[model samples]
Target: MSRVFVKKASYDNLDQLIAEIFTLYDINLRGKRVLIKPNMLGAFPPEHGNCTDPRLVAAVVREVRKQTDRIWVGDNPMRVQAGGGVDDSARISGIYEASQGYYVNVGAKARVISIGSEIIAQMPVSEYFLEADAIINLPKAKTHMIAGITCCVKNMFGAVVGSAKAKIHYDAGHAKRFTQFLVDLYKYFKPTLNIVEALTIMEGDGPTHGKIREGGKIIAGTSGVEVDAVVASMMGFQLNRLKFLQLASQAGLGECDLGKIEVVGDFEPWPNFELPSTYSGRPMDNIQVAQAAEIHEVWGQVGRLHPRFIEENCTACGSCAEICPAGAIALDPYPVVDEAKCVSCFCCAEVCPEAALVMPKEEAQTLFLRLNPQIREG
Candidate 1:
């Protein structure tokens, strides 16, 4: 059975708590090239709850230092602009300082590898990630627009370098395919250890752009899939609703069934934890279908389905136009989408810092019912 350890912690006591966890998990890093991967999603500050807490990163780095001095801490954030890279993101999130002078710009160098997924045949991955003897995955406990919740398993997507992430979203075309791609990627490059920063988590709608809540917990395990299973339960998300977790479990990646796993210490599910606006906690046999219907392909027959831009929230930063793989968006003083050229990838929505670009969920249940004639609304 997979084992997960949960502890209620604070930044003041994190270093001691992490050292204890490392010992309990028996994570050995002596004389090894170790890469510490943290959730540096963008240039957002820690208080925003977008990236992993810098204090958590610092604690992990110190523990790793006890065994090995050869350590690198980094992640490839979504490229919102032309010149912005991992260094800018790391510094802004205070991860560079917290890394204790071990931060490396992972996006600077990459090596191409064969992914062999249905979405893409080959892709670029970070050289630092590939050269590591062991990878310590540090993911924030947060809601994601696409994956419902991005914890241990979804965090591995940072292994892909630069704009290739947007391209992968474009190739996958919708939520179901994209989720499958995530499972495939995780299986290929599974981390040696998984640790989640649940002390502060994002809700409402995230990975970015969500309200912060006090989770007051840290979860750790060797299996990313199993760790994510525990996180989903803590957030009050039905295991069936997260398709990627189900797929990962089916692929024999780890035991996703909570009953089958071993849980250690002070685990209590949060009461009334808010989920993403896109998810309604409805009952459905095909959860992937529900996700696709709500987020990506609303007007299936009509080809005009695209992201709705919130003009007031936009900064005219041109991030949407820059990240569009199809070049479908143009800045006419403000952004405008050319319906015919748009691929409905939602890459624009993902890269929008201000939450300006969003999927339409005004009448989600009605629209989903209309689009899927066979599947009845819950």
Candidate 2:
């Protein structure tokens, strides 16, 4: 039977809490190369509830460092500096400071290794990760705009690095295919442990865009599939609906059945929150639709991206430009977004604190309806 631990603790008591978690899992770190993969989607602060909590990562790293000689922690951030530099190490370093453990950037330390042609042909994964004796996946439990939810399995996608992620998105248009890709990734490199930051879950359009919903808990398991299944269930989703869990189960990666799994500590259920139905209002053929027409159709008729510029909240920080994967947003006169280029990923909207970026309800509903008309209008 698969075992999962659920604990509630603040940063002050995190060290002890982590120890208890590892103890429950019977994890041994002595002389092991432990790699911690946290959700560093971008440099968003912890309070935003977009990325993994530094405290959780720090606590785990600290605990592992105590028992292990080697520890490396980092994630391949989405945005990269020119000449292929992914610099989010400093942010993670700040987390390690609290725990008094050293933080190292796996990106710079990464040595490219062959990933075999099962997932995405040939790709390079961090040598630190590849060479590690134990990998602890630390993922934030949040709703995702693309793959529905980003949990333990989805977090490893960061390991792919560079344009490979975007290319995967383009190659796997359907959610099922993307889920399959994640399963393939897990098959390629299995983690020694799976830990999820469910204390502060994000609702609505997430993984990035969403509202922070705190649950006050932490989950740890040896099986990524079982941990992900628990995380998904906590978010009011079925295991089967989560394509990654389904794919993983089919692949014989791990057990997805909760009834057959063992649970430890408090297993509290959370209130049901509304999540953004998948935006399906527009046709996939953006090539046919002009930028202006697409924007007008989505905003005017369908109503998708109701871009707003709140001068009061707007810091004009140019974060929108940097986060826009499509280069749809350009900073000049307070950030102009080329609707044609925008993939509606909502990276800018999530990063913006000024509440400057906005999407209307009608547009959201219509878009979701367009994409998922089968959701059944109730």
**In candidate 2, what are the lDDT values of residues 1-378, reduced to their tens digit?**
678877775556777888887887788889877788887766556677777788888788778877875777777765443122345433633444533445556565555555553545656666667777888898888876545578888888777765456546544533445567777877777888888888788876675667897778888898888888777667666555555677788888777788876877877666665443442233232111111212322343443453555666677877667656577777876888888766555556655645577544445545554534322321
Pick the TM-score winner: 1
Q: How far out, in Å, is residue 351 in model 1?
A: 1.9
TM-score of each: 0.91, 0.78
Candidate 1 stretches with Cα past 4 Å from truth are 80-83, 281-289, 292-305, 369-373, 376-378
- For every candidate in turn, the CA RMSD to the true structure comes to 3.1, 6.6
Q: Give the TM-score of candidate 2.
A: 0.78
lDDT of each: 0.81, 0.65
What lDDT is reached at residue 265 by model 1?
A: 91
Best-matching candidate per lDDT: 1
